[model samples]
Target chain A: MSANEEAARHREVRNAWALSAPALILLLVAAIGPLFIMLVYSFLTPGQYGNVEWKFSWDAWIGTLYSRDIFDGTLKLADAHLTIFWRSVKLSLLTTIITFIVGFPTAWFIATRSPRSRALWLFLITIPFWTNLLIRTFAINEIIRNEGLINSVLMWMGVIDQPINMIYTDTAVFVGMTYVYLPLMVLPLFASIDRFDMRLLEAGYDLYASRWQVLRRVIVPIVRPGIVAGSILVFIPALGAYVTPRILGGGKNMMIGNFIELQFGQGRNWPLGAALSVLLLIVVTIALMFYVRASTKGTNNG
Target chain B: MTTDVAVEARNAVKAFGQGETAVRALDDVSIQIRKAEFFTLLGPSGCGKTTLLRLIAGFETPTSGQILLDGKDITNDPPNKRPVNTVFQSYALFPHLSVAQNIAFGLEMLGRPRAEITKTVERMLALVKLEAMAGRKTSQLSGGQQQRVALARALAPQPKVLLLDEPLSALDYKLRKEMQLELKRLQTETGITFIFVTHDQEEALTMSDRIAVMSAGHIQQIGGPREIYTRPVNRFVADFIGETNFLSGEAGEGRVTLASGDVVQVEGAEGRKGKVTVVIRPEQVRLAEAGAAETIPATVESLVYFGTDTHCHLRLKDGTEMVARLQSPASGEAGLQQGQSVGLRFAPGAARVLED
Candidate 1:
């Protein structure tokens, strides 16, 4: 090629590299690099100066495999961790199921409305998202506290002789997590249900299917992918929730998140905390992968 | 007294909106569809043909009317309760179901015995020539296959009346023509009343035993395709059903005088003593050699040739443009060229007086 053509090719290559470098760097720093560090920490042992010791050993894995901490009262065993993990899973699952029950109908209702009404409903649902997460959590905490509005109302109505302790429980964690993640669940559900072809429902009606039969056979299958996506959005974050559980749950109903934070902060065991974080990551990844694969199969079958 | 009367709508009226803002979609319209015949509702868009079909299918309630199927009023029934099924314009096949499942859907809805449903579904698949594709998914099927699946699914239950709303409009020209023949055969074989809605006049003309031509929420004419086409009652039906050349004229007594001073006897227009339109088809205009006797003097304005025939556009001395289709080399070479002076004539009964 001529000199100018060669020069143009070089410029094109350089410009392409320049445009893609930032995103590549971001992926490496935010995802690949942290994962690599976590893998190394999973193998390392903690040193005296609150740092990881440079060594290659199966000590942390073995420590995780066996029940040393629970025996010595320094840390908890598999049962404690497993119990916490199961509780987290159950809470997150409940949140997802409840969110779908509340959100699907709301999304379908909004989607079926006129465009003006749809916009107003979407705006109302999104308004809570504009507030800071901390403020929203604190607001819920105040509303459901022992001396808060709910207890006060019950006292005035003579429904209770004493104020009910509503906050600082697993129920409080669920309420707070659901409130925080309700919008995240709703938007995707709305999008998927909006894309549903309304004519298919009419076809179902013409075929002699009752109203509920149409819902089961037509509407639900068509919106299954959205349900899966929305559940993942709600469940994954609810599993690893720290602030909501910490504030609304206080210290009584400490979830796996609080346990991990305790290992890293008060326990001063870097490797153990990293190990717990890694375990949480694996559980979430597996659940999400299974959900995605199943929902994809559902979409294809449809 | 009339066991053959399959569907009857009495003074059906459907209005949109409410009160003063309302627009009448079906204005006191009534139609009777007999059993074992192909009836077509032909009209332009916004003419309420599809609305009328939906009313029969029980998808929409008439503002004020009675819809009877087999001597029982079904106007208050929901779609699922009615004895009718519709093949939608978009097909509306269950996207999640296979071809067999889609066809078997209606049978399943009827709470039929499983073995009987299977037999009927298989029979329908064979009827639509889609037996081989029954195992395939609906989304994987081609448009023609989907069309056949929709047809089979609607027919499987053997509804009292089958309503098709522009079912063949989505297919290509060749497939549409093929489906038209297949549908006629299917109707005859099954002996079911078919009420089909279409805006294409050729489709109505080719497939229907009778046609109801509608315009502006009213039935302008209803008869056999030939009767509706050849004996249209108004200018809209004349222009809508086929191409027509309109000549403005003044009518008094039994004769109408064209602007060119040619007077023709138009029966049934005796009392119309004001401005009127005389409608004539282009093919009805006969071309003659220059200076031919009893022919109006005209000049060819344009010539368009097809493989089978040639169309000659002419302007009379009074500047009224007309077109004539000439077939064969002898007829085409009757000395006609652009801007060439010629003569034009029509038989006495060819043109009809019309009101808009």
Candidate 2:
């Protein structure tokens, strides 16, 4: 290459890096810096009063799946910790599924509205976001509690003499997370469905495809990117959700987020908390990788 | 109930919206398409041609009338329940499916066996001459290839009747012409009843066995191409099919007297009374020297030279403007100029009289 061309190319590369330097520095300081600290803490010894010491040890990582008997120091399965992890993964998966079931039709309805009124329907979907997430979770807490609107209405109508116990259960946590993460699922679905060609439905019907076949074969495959985006958006945050479970499940239905908080705040095991936090990050990264694979496959086929 | 009639629409009316703001999209339209014939619904946009085609395809149900397939009342049948397919104006091939898969779609939906669907898909690919493109996605194909895939997909199931709603309108001029002939060849080879909808008059004339010219939700006329072109029943059909000169005249006793005081014989003016519109095609009018026998005096307004023909714009003495298309000479000259006086001669029995 000519020297002039090489010099000009080097200047362009320098300008690009110079423009991005601020973002790169901010990311290193504000994001990865704390994760580095957590990683280091996960390898160190936990102090007595909820802090980590400089001495390296593997006890915190081992304690993630096992705990020692206080008397004999025998390593055994961490039953309580495993239950919390299972509940976290299970509830998060169910929340993703339930949100999709409810959000698909809602997004389809909003996307099919008249152009002027479609804006109104989409605005209504996002109205829940204007309120604080904590307040919203608490509001759900009021509705499903023993004296909540559903039980009150059922009792008033004489359908049942006693209120069904729905609070402080896994069901309550499930309901709460689904409500909290529903809009996240719906918006991406709407963005994809809004661009969907309605004429394909007619074309499908003309081609002898029933409505159900059309949905499965045509609509679902075409809008899969939205499904993946919405799933990841709901799944990752729901896996790490804390406030909704705390408010609705009372004290027993602890998710991973609440369990990790317990290590730092009251359990006095900072290193274990750091390790659990790192584990959650790994789970999220794996989920993101699956999403990337799925979306790329969809593009390749299309 | 005749076996030759493939599809019949009886007084179909389709209205959009309700009450005060309702728009009548198809107004009491009735048509009978014969078996294995290419029938065209030709009109300008919003003229209800597409609506009629949709009614035949069962995409739109009639509001107050009946649609029949082989004497069976199919007005209430859903599109998927009917044995008919449509090639949409947009050629809405599923972008996710490969070319072969697209052709196999309708067959698969019909619950055809795997081996049969594969055989039919291969045959359809060969029919449309796209065998080499079977593995490619619909989005990867060119416009013409996508169009062929759409045709193959719609033709795979061997529907009793096929509907095409301006399928070639998206193509360029050259490709549109090529597909027109290609579509005709497909229809002939398959011997399927083809119901085509388009607004281009030349396309309808070139490709259809019969043409139904529509206007404002009404069928103006229905006949073969030659009949519709040479013998339109009214002014709308005459003006829409091609260029025509409408001269205000009074008709009686096998001849018509123009407002310019010139008398000319009209083919269909026999036994007609006063106040008629004379329909004369541009190609039927011949220009001669001024004051020739049986010729009307006119002044040449302008001339437009197309490759094969020269359009002579002329004005009658009564101030009525008319156009005459004359064959361009081999020497590349029309031998006519503006503002020159000329005699306009109508070939014997060239004019048809329409009631005013």
Candidate 3:
């Protein structure tokens, strides 16, 4: 390489690092800093009145997996923690599936719109992101409650004798999550599907493929990276969800988010909360790994 | 309505948008393609050739027309139900599927048995000479390889007719030439009607059994390649296909009086008088001694040697320009030089008379 070209390349590398330094420093302070603290404190004993003690402790990790008969050293399943984890997983999985079912068609409609109107449709998709999540969940609360718009209309139409108990149920939680996270799914789905060549659809039809076969065999496989990316985006947040389940699932329903909050607030077990937070972070990391693998697999195949 | 008429369009009209924004893409166009023949729609870009092909493929519905396949009205039928397939210009092979799987897709769409699909896919792979790359993804193949895979995939179902929409326009010149001959061979071997669309006049002339030359959403002429080249019906056909020297004059009794008041005899001008455009092929105009029977007086303007032949640019006494393509040996022996006056002779019927 020439000296001039080498010097110019070094300048580019320096420029990249200079641009990245601010974000790197902010992440170290805001995210990794707290995470390191949590990891360290998970191994320390809980002091009285919600503080960490310097003394060593194994009880927090032990409490995550099992309950103890200290005398016999025999282990039993800790259904208390396990139930919340399983509930979180189920809720997130259901939310991801339902969001995809609704988001795919909406994304397709937006992607196929005329270029002039595409911006308007995409703007509508992002309107929800402009509002506060807490407000959106509570706004949904009014509609699903007794004497709300749906039940009032249904009863007025003679479909029901009285207002149904739609609030304070798992159905409300499912609905809330799907509503809030739909835009997340739609954005990525739009990016992938929008870049797709519409001529391929015509080619599929010309080659005698049925509509369903085209969607299944051609469209879905091509947009799969977007689906996986959106799954991680929606599922991870919904798994650790706290506000919607509390507001719409109505406090009677508890998720992993509420459990971790209770450990630090009412239960006052700092070490256990830190350990549970670490575990949740681990689950999220695995989800991120899956996203990386899926994206890289796309490039390797190309 | 005959059985030999593979595909026919009657007065097809396609208009996009409405009111002020409306553009008529195909204006009352009609043509018939014969069965088992290599037919081509030849035109420049935006001449509505692709739109016509799309109408036949069921991608677009004509505003007013009847499209028939083997005497069956299929204007409203969906593409999936039609007895036709296409090799797309982009070669839209499924990126996620292997080349073999791409070839098998149409067969599977037809609900063919798995064993039959496998056998047909194998045969098609070998036919396109992509057998060694059968298991590779479509994206892994080169542009030429992918084009062949697309051809194999579209041809696997053995449709009654195949629509190729400029399928060779994307490749480099070398690959395009190779694929052009390859596609011709494929069409001949399969004995299926192939309607190819292209903007290339050379490709159309080289590969088509019959060429439909379109312009401004209307078909200007349709005939065998040789006939279209040799005997164009209008000035547009003459100017578009190849080089021609247009001589405008007053015609009468198989002759024209040049503007310089020199009487010249020409073919295809019988019983016609008044102003007309006479298109003469460069190769047909012969040069001899300064004065000869059935010849006109002209001066050599310039000479451009292209190895095997030399194009002698000439100007007649009336200030009309013409070009004559002369072979190297004969033109050299004639001792023709720039600024030299000579007699230009043409055989009977070598010139065509057309309305300006």
Ten contiguous residues with the weakest lDDT in model 3 chain A: A293-302
User: Cα lDDT for residue B172, model 2?
Assistant: 96
Q: In what order do the candidates fall by TM-score, top score first?
A: 2, 3, 1
- Give the TM-score of each candidate: 0.89, 0.96, 0.89
> Model 3's DockQ?
0.52
Query: Model 3, A1-302: lDDT tens per residue?
Result: 99999999999999999999999999999999999999998888888889889999898888777878789988898887787788788989999999999999999999999999999999999999899999999899989999788998999999999789999888888899999999999999999999887878887888788999788777888888888888888999999999999898876677888888887898888888899999999988987897778765764233
Q: How much is B118 displaced in model 3, in angstroms?
A: 2.8
Candidate achieving the largest lDDT:
2
Error of 1 at B117 (Å): 3.9
By summed lDDT, the worst window of 10 consecutive residues in model 2 chain A runs over: A293-302
Clashes per candidate (backbone, < 3 Å): 0, 0, 0
- Model 1 vs truth, CA RMSD: 3.9
TM-scores of chain B alone in all candidate structures, in the order given: 0.95, 0.98, 0.93
Q: Write the per-residue lDDT of candidate 1 for residues A241-287, one digit (tens) a residue.
A: 88999999897687888877886677666687778778889878997
Off by over 4 Å in 3: A1-29, A65-76, A147-162, A287-302, B1-3, B19-22, B289-293, B329-338
Docking class of predicted structure 1? medium
Evaluate candidate 2 and give its CAPRI docking class based on DockQ: medium
| Model 2 misplaced regions, further than 4 Å | A1-12, A147-163, A291-302, B1-3
